[model samples]
Target: MSRYVALGSSMAAGPGIRPSAPGAPFGSGRSARNYAHLVAERLNLDLVDVTFSGATTAHVLHERQRSARPQIEALDGSEELVTITIGGNDVGYVPLLMAASLPAIARRLLAGRVRELFDRAARERALDDVADALRGVGTAVRGRAPQARVVFVDYLTLLPAEGAPAAPLSVEHADLGRFVCARLEDVTAAAAQATGCELVRAGHASRGHDGWSADPWAVAAGLPLPWRPAPFHPNAAGMRAVADLILEQVGKN
Candidate 1:
């Protein structure tokens, strides 16, 4: 079997999904059913999954997360495949989504501060950090595994399209969430192009399947259910969708 190393944050780890990945640290929050595991099963790959919840690119490239090695450190020149799904945490995408889900009174009370955090200038600055870190990841991976097929899978869409009724989000906050999501998608795509890596347009493939859609691939913000995905994260269905999307490219090659 060819070796495959998966890297990234909660979006890739499938936090709170049932049946924790065998031997994964509790803090990692990795699901046995996450896209990486699923892809490995279908392709019979020797998988080294290093994804953890709340990982920033810093964690993937250098910082030890929850005492585990930096995610990139899991790689060696022998691997044939790698997949990355990161950068949302760097720009506070999930935090903003959580803020949007606060109760009406709480949201109103915190609106000013939240708006400041999402200010266009601040967001752009954070995005610059994300872009640079992604470039670093691409460079390090290429150096470590010159023969691997690197794939940059961007985040799934988390919000309803513009003008859709997104409950829990007042119109203003909903609009703000959409804008941030879009910018993150753009940055991820640009990084993949600049790195000469294969790209999986998960965000584009999930357009009408946002958390607010009838058949949501992503989990909408709400009370956490036992063994279910955390709010603003991918659900099992989303994981399956992503796995299949990945196979579409890998199987062809």
Candidate 2:
């Protein structure tokens, strides 16, 4: 039997929305739908779900190095596939962007000087930290499962557009979102190249301003629970979209 190990954050763990299965957690009032389970079901592989809510790449390394609680040894000696979606929480980048944007909104509420200052600093730090974390994740995954086909997925773009109005604020939030996503892509791609791991560009499937204009994947922000997470997290449909993209890449590899 081909065994698969999936490691990452709540997105990989299927927090808000995922395909239903026995023993799955139920909290966000949505079915436990994670892309890992979806990929496993699609490919009919034995899945080792080593994912947790609020996980970062650094967290994964610590757990592996120390065999800490929620250790990834649960997926040790993997046989075939290894999918990872990490680095979003590292440096608390996402929250930082949200925080920085809030005060700017309290003032003039535009992507002006204040937004620029916060975004530039946050993006630089996040990129560097995430790159380091990806290196660690790549090394750890390769060490554990030498034969497995490892994949590192990039974060999805969450911003609206240049001139669109964003909820709870202005379109400036979208700009920061784009900046963060772009940096994530760079670090993930570079790390994958350095570590000889396959890169999965999950961001392309996201509904950006243009994509949302045609076909939106996630609910509008500040709508309601089960529609969207706090702000950056995906809804059920968004998770499913991610699962689909992951399965596609996994199948090709």
Candidate 3:
């Protein structure tokens, strides 16, 4: 009666933090210190962590990678809790943002045209697809784990109020990235409402302390994890924040 299943992409998987666990389809993304593990430890629940580095909603619905089982299959109507942070990779979130921004920062001295790598029309279509996929995921989870409390966890803020300084990206580039992330959060909220899952708005909870700040919960695009090669994901502080947030919702301190 204490089974807790965790699933999602690199953020939920705790990419940079160690000791990374190995799986068949995706070798190592799950961290021993991820929010899921922390929450499980705090609540004394059996943890079934199946998060991967590049997992899309498709991965959760029907294994996207070889040897990777459908993430939802972990449930059997016998779990107590479930938490997930997904959809970022679906539209190439971090990578696209970086690609669109880095060139500007690298050559800001020249005042060149900051080429827009992302096709606006294509991006909009892809976001729509994400919303559809999210609806499917929510329905599947509710059906599979009828007794479990499902929480759709959102990603942490990646930039400070003034934008990330480490990228040394221009104010324009940083502001654009932040705006895109904010829209993504909005999309997640709509999906959560449509599917009846309690939304854990981590983005709102994790403000100011973005990759740029001294007390950041999230890391910059290339900030390496302690003793690991993880980047563009939540750091230890971010993971703890997620765990605490979930615990708070579950009525536990």
Best by lDDT: 1
Q: On residues 1-253, what C-alpha lDDT tens digit does candidate 1 reach at each position?
A: 8999999999999998888999988678899999999999999999999999999999988898777989999998898999999999998888887877888687688888778665767877888888888888887887888999999999999888999888887787788778888888888888888887888999999999988899999998787665679888999999999999999988787
Evaluate all candidate structures by whole-model CA lDDT and list the values in order: 0.89, 0.65, 0.78
lDDT of candidate 2 over 180-205, digit per residue (tens): 77778888888888898998787766
Please give the RMSD of candidate 1 to the true structure: 1.7
- Could you tell me how far off, in angstroms, the CA of residue 177 lies in candidate 3 after the best superposition? 1.7
State the displacement of the C-alpha of residue 49, model 1, in Å, after optimal TM-score superposition: 0.4
Report the lDDT tens digits of candidate 3 across residue range 127-238.
7898888888888998898888888999998877753364655566566666667777888888878888888889999988787677888877664445763556788899
Q: TM-score for every candidate vs. truth?
A: 0.95, 0.79, 0.87
Q: Score candidate 2 by lDDT.
A: 0.65
> Which pairs clash (backbone N, Cα, C closer than 3 Å) in model 1?
none
